[model samples]
Target: MNRATVSSSLPSSPSRRSFLGLGLGAGAALALAACGSSKGASGGTGTGSSVLKWGWALPTSWDPVFSSAGWDVHTLSLVYAGLTKLDPHGAAVPALASAWKYNADGTRVTFTLRPGLKFSDGAALDATAVKKSLDRGRTDPKSLVAPQLTSVKAVSAPDPTTVVIDLTHADYQLPNLLAGKTGMVVNPAAFTTNAAGLASKPAGSGPFTLTSYTQNAKAVLRRNPTYWDAAAIKLSGVEVYPLPDASTVVAALQSGQYNVAQIPGSQVEAAKAAGLEVQVIPSMVVATLDVNSSKAPFDNPKVVEALKYAIDREALLKTQAFGHGEVSYQPFPKGYAGYDPNSANLFPYDPDKAKELLAQAGHAGGLDVTLTTAVAQGEPEQIQAQLKKVGINAKIEVIPQAQFTQIIYIQHDRQVAVDQFAGRDSAVQAFQVLFGEEGLMNPGRTTPPELTAAVDKVTRTPLDSPDYPTVLQAATATAVRSTPNVFLYTVPRILARTKSVSALPEFTVVQRFEGVSVG
Candidate 1:
């Protein structure tokens, strides 16, 4: 958010020599080396002792409004403070806005800003800035979060600190919804000059300011001294490197390249053996098979139903996730409010029934289709073998991880792909992104009428009502019975960090860095 940091040029896919030539510093070079290395990094402490080197995926876009990936919400959270933030229990708490109250009918909500909040640009980040961001999120054609704010009729700032949001109907999901990407406020001055430039140059009131960034390599951030919650942020700086490879995670953490890093379930023991503290924290993420309903094999309802019964969720739990996952039948996890007990075994593994359904659908000889995925993991191969048992011959097509989002979410060309959905903060928003007409994961862009009506009941019901959870479960049942997405298993986020680092809380959504410190 500092002008000096913002003015720094962000180079794309530069060679090692060219990267250092940019003069970003030794930290940038260490991040690149760590990112590209399979073996341990050239040690001797990559960065300052006060700086936390984190190994994680780089955000697809820096701007929350234009970001296509759901996980980007966490990375952007470092630079942009939202109106509300979620506690460890996933409940909404105040951040920029001190407090908020809804009207009697729940059709309007008023938020009171904390006194004297300022953006990195030294501009007033008051009610007017919040209104502008909310308006843009709802009205901007390019905003990926627009679907979550369709019910917002208008956003108004009556005074310097009072912001009001008028909704078309009674909706109680706003607080939690705002806690995520939709609630993050951007500097109006920066966006007005060049909206697209905000993707690389961010200006927010979050705890950290981007000092330097190189695409697919690393992002170096320095502490924002002016952050409203400065006392909570302990790290002087943070160096983030994109290390998506699970195999390299243990080595990276053990070699002092990354003090904390996300590892696969299989690597948990390895991390523990290396004297690193491990936390296998439960998450709302569900690995599912995204089926294009408008496509060839899936157009037939019977074919879609057949594939649902074809998969063995238990086998996938053991094989694909190495028993670090729970077999799931719906989008919401088992303990979540939206999970439906009745729908747990709606389409249990029954190859005979699957074959019968295929025969009835005039595909008795079987049908050939593609199982596309970005990662070359055992899950897709396992799914391919299982589908073959029910006469569904699946050819696996591996696409580059960089192009996966473009092909599946943007271009909508995938027939059936393996995707892990990092569920949203609100169940209503999660449903919209999974089964709604404009959902990013729904490549076919099709949703059943039953699902739409069911989710509507969830939004209208107040969160305080006892019937709220029931309506949510009903919607889950509808989605489970009607949608083509095959729920496989729920896996926890496995993180390995040094014993010196502490205070990593268990968050239901993406990982949070607030209060995390390296002692």
Candidate 2:
């Protein structure tokens, strides 16, 4: 099995106590025909609300590979399909690939693609296409999605329906990794049309085909009649509209301009009073504060520990999160297999201890730093207020979503950055993104040998092996001890829709239109 390793030293102070105080937390309509008129020219399904006007508080962009915006994934999921899909609960399940078998060494994986699958453009989905897609990701150095593929040794087509992938290291959680939005497959022919064709107009073998799109405005998708899983599709078309303001999203939902929209925790009661169906699920999304260890003050382990101790997660959670989330101590949230109960209780709220550690690091009075974040569902203003009490002066700067990737992921200059991680199908998914050598989430900027080794052990070990639990525990321990980043809370995803829709899945926050229906 191929394995990737990471290493880092433990900080001088013990891990802080777990944060517990934070407060947490699709459809259609039809037109009516004249009474007993037997339906004239407008007969078919009463037009059936052909377009699903979805209102989200984020901008729309066709470039899925370059944009980290969650809205991009929502659009891409409609236009493209991956080899494997993540279930509602964030577990990896087969999608385009009918079945898969891992070699005993775990370094190699062979997938039996479903035969007769073809792109909307009528091109067959064979091993060559898969290879081409993988190759593009590997070769594009500027691509954020490419680093996920450490190395693809070979991509061979044993037959029209089989694609064998040879990896440089054993990645037991490879399937989950592929399920990420970044690993979406694109049509090889379309990709070659222009060097950057896929970025603007993605082509894939999904239930819906992108018919039209307007950047930062709206996108339209039409049903793919040639879609292999057409029978499972319900809606004829979907229209996604970007509504970035929280108040605007609430107003739209109430006005019936949108069938579905994200409701902030503060508005849950008001939505319920208006007779809308409100559903809340544990979101895999987490918000955290990243300390820049590569720069001054924070370069010292003591300063990092002091900072962690000073911020009261409970107060932040209660005030900013509206009591809708759980305090997170590590990258892996509760309900995940790798979550460490012991580590969750390790850190306690202690301002005195935090001050002592700061003094030990040579900053007895306090320090001045700039905190950066993008406006989202959380309470950034309130979180900052709590940080000020600990002797640190934190200035908040909000940036646009398009510039977020460059500011946080690439530049990595902020003193403390508030960021989020999308839920993944497996623990390894969290491990790779937060601790992998080139992981985008490692804001502390430390890549120690010990941290790398621990993460490697967890990724390489088979999920069913006896030692799997041990490896997970060790990795979590390593993360807490090193304090690469502070894990805050798992925010709940609140979605509101009309009662006309049914059969919604339970696990993922993203809607799967297959089983959904209009009354």
Best by TM-score: 1
Best by lDDT: 1
Q: Please state the error at residue 4 of candidate 2 in Å.
A: 20
Angstrom error at residue 517, model 1: 1.5
Candidate 1 TM-score versus the reference: 0.88
lDDT of each: 0.78, 0.65
Q: Report the lDDT tens digits of candidate 1 across residue range 1-519.
A: 111111112221100000000111223222211222211211222212367788976676778887766777768888898887776656566788877778878789888888899996578998999999888888898887788898899999999988999999988788779988788899988789999777667878887777677776888877765677777776767888875578888887878889989888888888899999998887777888988988888988899999999999999888877889788888877667787999878889999999999999999999999999876868899999999999999999998766776787668877899888768878888888888888877888989998999988988776556687788899999898888888888978788899878858787665777677787
Q: What residue pairs clash in candidate 1, if any at all?
A: none
Q: Write the per-residue lDDT of candidate 2 for residues 169-277, one digit (tens) a residue.
A: 8877776667656557778887687646455466887777666555545666666655656777666676677653666666677676777766767767777777778
Question: What TM-score fits each model?
Answer: 0.88, 0.85
